[model samples]
Target: MEKNKEVSANNKVDVDSRRDFLTKTPIPELIIKLSIPTIISMLVTALYNMADTYFVGKISTQATASVGLVFSVMAIIQALGFFCGHGSGNFIARMLGAGKVKEANEMASTGFCMAMIFGIVIAVVGNIFINPLASAIGATKTSMADTKAYMSIILIGAPFMMCQFVINNQLRFQGRAVYAMVGLMCGAVFNVGLDPLLILVFDMGVRGAAIATITGQFMSFLVLLFISLRGQTIKVNIKNVRLNGFYLKEITNGGAPSLFRQGLAAAATLLLNKYAGKYGNDAAIAGMSITTRVMMMLGSAVIGFGQGYQPVCSYNYGAKLKDRVREGYFFCVKYGTIFLVFAGAICFIFAPDIIWAFRKDEEVVAVGKVALRFQACVLPCMATTVITNMMLQSMGKGIKASITSSARSGIFFIPLILILPRVFGIRGVEVTQTIADILAMGIAIPFAVSELRKMKKME
Candidate 1:
């Protein structure tokens, strides 16, 4: 009994120490320290996603296009994951900052359970209507079989995948990005290791790729679940789970931006794929898909860095240290934009090479290069857009955050994608995303400025 009491006291000390560090650390140093692991996690996650496309690219053009089409489904899965994870995580951080540790635990527990249930529903329903679902995602006749093969396995793993994502975001919000990084990196590495063997050696084709992807997600889910159960950062227990209106409201308010952002990404991809099909052929679809993947890879780092700022923003806002939140936001935007500038320059220089590296078909390269270069040119603008949305969401400004989040994919891209191709021919399809990024940035500026002014006034 005495030993157990001593251990409990030590755990409390550790927890308090971490809270102090998070609250007291210098803004720049803290953001960097927090961001590095998250950036690695994001990059590795992106790499594994690319690995699936890359290995599938080796199969056939139809196969690659099939993978691309199914990406919309993947996007939706990711959307749900982020919605629950970010929603609960934002509240959890703030609750902790306000010294409401029990409420934070309750939020985490409720979010995880809800996400898992949601995933199960999606998986079951998706499998039931697999054929029409494939057609809805723009799968061509040739790509239909592979799309079914991939989407089925992916949907089957949805529960694990969503749950894993929830735990990961929660850990990061708790200032345990290293633990989150470890879990994600392990899964990514495992996925990469298995991809070639299953796709090539086993000759299981797209099914093999799907299996590998889900296997990684399940492993990651286990890793994260283990960490949370061990009471490392925020413990997720059934007892702490509350499914009431009060908690749900907090989660929705904090997470609505991510839902719009990622959910619209899925919707936009569906439109893009459908438009690509109309404009050209499988090659066109593959080209746009590859371009999207490359841009996402580049953007992942920025998102990860922005996420690092989220906990800081939420914590300080809850603690009423508006100055710290304001400072952290600007710090992330400046450094993130500078880094993207360099990344964009490199991508622009090697657009063709990058496209060809993924899928070596001549038509694919032709279609992808122009789009990739256009996106690279405007990539730096994403820092402002993404950070603004993240900040607004973390601060629980749901309306502004949702508007900012939906701007690029839903508000601007949807309209442009519909009208541009008719007017500008193929060039319209190629440059749609770049135009969206610019317009989204324009929308984000005022939102960011207004919030900053409010924070300043609070001083």
Candidate 2:
């Protein structure tokens, strides 16, 4: 009994210490501390994603296009994961900040449960219509077999993948990013190790790649589940599942931006594939696909860095420490833009070499080279665009956040892709995302400025 009491007291002290650390830490130090792990997590995740493209790139351009085509499905899975994770995680951070631990637990459990159910449903329904889905995602006859094989295996792991993402996000929002990073890194390391063995030695081809990816996801799910079950942060319990309108409403408000952003990413990818398929061929599709993945991999660091600001923003805003939120936002935008500018310059200078590193097809490299440089030119715009969207979402301004998030892929890209191809031919395909980035930045600027001004008033 005495030992248990001492343990309980120690836990209380730890919690108090964390609360003080989050509320009182200097802005630059706090953001950096939170960001490093999150950045590593993001980079590892991106690297594993690139691993599929890299290894598959060696098989054939057709096979690479098949991987690219199936990426739309992967994006949808990620969409749902981020929606549930960010929605609940944001609410949990605020609840914790306000000392509403019970509500935080309820949100965590409900969101996780919902993701699991939805993942299972998507997996079943997706596999049922696998052929049709493959065609819809722009799989040509040559790539059809590989696309279906890869996508089917990926769908089977949806529940694990989505749930793992939820747990990771919850940990990050709860100021446990290092734990989240470890879970993600372990899975990534496993995935990388399995990729070459499965694809080359075992000779499973794209199916091997799919199996490797899912295997890593399942491992991550187990790791994160163990962590959550230990009751270190908010424990995800079935008893706390509140699948009611109130929780759903909050989740929607907080997660809608992510849903819109990721869902539109899926849609935009499909459209881009279709347009590329129509204008050129499998090589065009392959080139654009490589461009998308590489750009996303490069952009991950900025997104991860922005995420570091999220818990700080939500926690302090909940605690009514508006000054910290404002300061963190300003600091992130300044540094994020600087970092992206340098990253973009490197990509722009080595566009051909980068594209060649993925797939050596002359046509693929030619198409991808121009696209990479064009997008990289405007890539710094994303620092502002993403930071603004994240800030709004973390602060519970869902409508504003959703609108800003939608602008990049939905409101902007869709129209540009449709019209530009008609006028400029294939060059339209290369530049669609660039125009979208500029427009997204234009939209985000006002929202970020407006919110920062409001935060200042509150301070």
lDDT of 1 at 65: 89
Clash pairs of candidate 2?
A: none
Residue 84 local lDDT, model 1: 98
State TM-scores per candidate. 0.98, 0.98
lDDT (tens digit, per residue) of candidate 1 on 1-459: 999888767766766776787789999999999999999988987886799999999998888888899999999999999999999999988887877776888999999998989999999999999999999999988889999999999999999999999999999998889999999987987899899999999999999999999999989999989988996447899898899999889889988899999999999999999999888889999999999999899899999999899988888888898998999999989998999999999989999999999899999999999999999999999999999999999999999999999999999999999999989867899999999999999999999999999999998
- Any idea what lDDT model 2 has? 0.92
Instruction: List the RMSD of every prediction in angstroms.
Output: 1.3, 1.4
Q: Which candidate leads in lDDT? A: 2
Q: For model 2, how does the per-residue alpha-carbon lDDT over 1-459 read when each residue is reduced to its tens digit?
A: 999888667656656666778899999999999999999988988887799999999899998999899888888998999999999999999988887777999999999998999899999999999989999999999899999999999999999999998999999998999999999988998899999999999999999999999999999899988898896547899999999999999989999999999999999999999899889899999999999999999889999998899999999999999999989988999999999999999999999999999999999998999999999999999999998999999999999999999999999999999999889878999999999999999999999888888888877
- Report clash pairs, candidate 1: none
TM-score of 2: 0.98
lDDT of 1 at 54: 97
Candidate 1: minimum summed lDDT over ten consecutive residues — where? Answer: 7-16
